[model samples]
Target: MLDRRRVLQTLAGLFLSSFGLGGYAYAWEPAHQGVTRYRLKPARWPEGRRLRLAVITDLHVGGPHMPVARVRQIVEQTNALKPDLTLLVGDFVASRTRRSSDPAPAEWAAELARLQAPAGRFAVLGNHDWWQDERAQKELRGPTQSTVALEAVGIPVLENRAVRLQTGAGPLWIAGLGDQEAFVLRRRPRGLPYGLDDLPATLAMIRDDAPVILMAHEPDIFARVPSRVALTLSGHTHGGQVRLFGWSPIVPSRYGNRYAYGHVRENGRDLVVSAGLGTSKLPIRLGAPPEIVLIELG
Candidate 1:
């Protein structure tokens, strides 16, 4: 039966190819880091003011692929870009329990402190940052350990807060919302809020009509973002952590691949979702390699 033998050979070939690909995704792609750059001129952005932003998110430190040494490399690479502002979108701690080491927050924060940005370095906590803080979760309030560690190293964690900064471009507002899925693990009583994010309050903090840049850990909030905000930066999906040909089968977001990665523009609003560095549940990466996103906005 020649036809039968051919079918068996084809199946064997498919198995071998898949096995090799799996090996590469697990061992090589997870450690290989790259920079993904985007240039945007949002409608509300100042005409003459060009801002270079270095966005680092989902560091997931202490994972096998993201040791302290790798963080140093990231800092050095970002510093080389010499961005006007450095924004940390969060997830400073490791997400997975197995095969992952836990580095003290101070250790990673110290390295992050070395990141150079002329305008200044600002941060916002992610879901993992909240999840990692057992005490904060138990209490249903924060000052998460990641927040303390980052602030200790001079990085201000903006939670439902906005700061007005005078940049070469002009006066701009950087608003950061708390992690939307912060209490995913814990059950709450009825009428008790689950997420710490407060978008309206954060926006209210902005006094003027200056263009606002919102740092939200998850891109799901992009739907509610109004035209007043120039740009919204987020990084939690990690581009589905295994994108294939621009499609992700298991995107963590409710919107699927719509906000999975890159600059997304909708309804005259803009969002940039970084693929992010470090792995989550599983330490494997395929088409979605680890990346540090650089945004040049005007």
Candidate 2:
């Protein structure tokens, strides 16, 4: 016969193990559908010209769990919004360490290529992409291959660079910087090409007359951005991964709570950080569901 304490301990271990498994499964399922709308009020945007922009990020594509079908569905839904411009804010593929080693990013890229917009469709690299060295090679979700794949289907990937888009009235200056996290790694800095030269100086290169919209994968870089930028778009937080009843489980940031999740304003500039469409390491999201944000530039 087993002792009382041993029996209790065995039961407790089973209960805890089951709870962990259940929680993981619950968070892994892709929940929430339909579009989220936001009317942005920018002080510098020209009057009477409203730009429809759709932002999607954290699609850690290339897993049996992620499946290209999901990406196709996301693209179809996004195109239905009829955005003037679509921005892919990075993390296109899951890091090698994260995936189960079956599906690859090429499959996902083909699905992502299906996305389209009238004015343009653009993208930026995520930390995961850098870790996978997709920038150096032309295959499997590398920055070069990922960019090439998108451009093939008409979406351009901006890496620490800027592009000028012409609206009905005039042109708007758009810029994108690579993942800032890659820059901090001293040992393998060259291993990842996710460094920004000088954010302040880069914005200076764009025309001052046009409204500047910038994309940096990590929102933490917002502090370094120059004042001329009208708005900054970012991801990587996944909106705190797991949001409790009234709090986020763990907000992984250097500043801690300064820019944890969602839309925030700093130094009179606007920032829209998506809750994201896909999961990272654990493949789960709680109170915070996957999101697709539609920003009406006003």
lDDT digits (tens) for residues 1-298 of candidate 2: 3332343344335434787744553434344445678898776777887888899998877633466778888989998888888899988876454445635556677777777776677888777666655344322233454556666765677766788888653688878875666434234434444354347656757865888899888888887776678788988877765666735546556654566667778777888888788776555566667888899987
Candidate 1 lDDT score at position 31: 91
Mind sharing the TM-score for model 2?
A: 0.82
TM-score of each: 0.92, 0.82
Model 1: worst 10 consecutive residues (lDDT sum): 1-10
Regions of candidate 2 where Cα sits further than 4 Å from its true position:
1-34, 98-102, 134-145, 183-186, 189-194
* Deviation in Å, model 2, residue 189 alpha carbon: 6.9
Please give the lDDT score at residue 19 for candidate 1.
80
Best by lDDT: 1
The 10-residue segment with the lowest total lDDT in model 2: 134-143
Residue ranges of candidate 1 with Cα displaced over 4 Å? 1-17, 97-101
Candidate 1, clashing residue pairs?
none
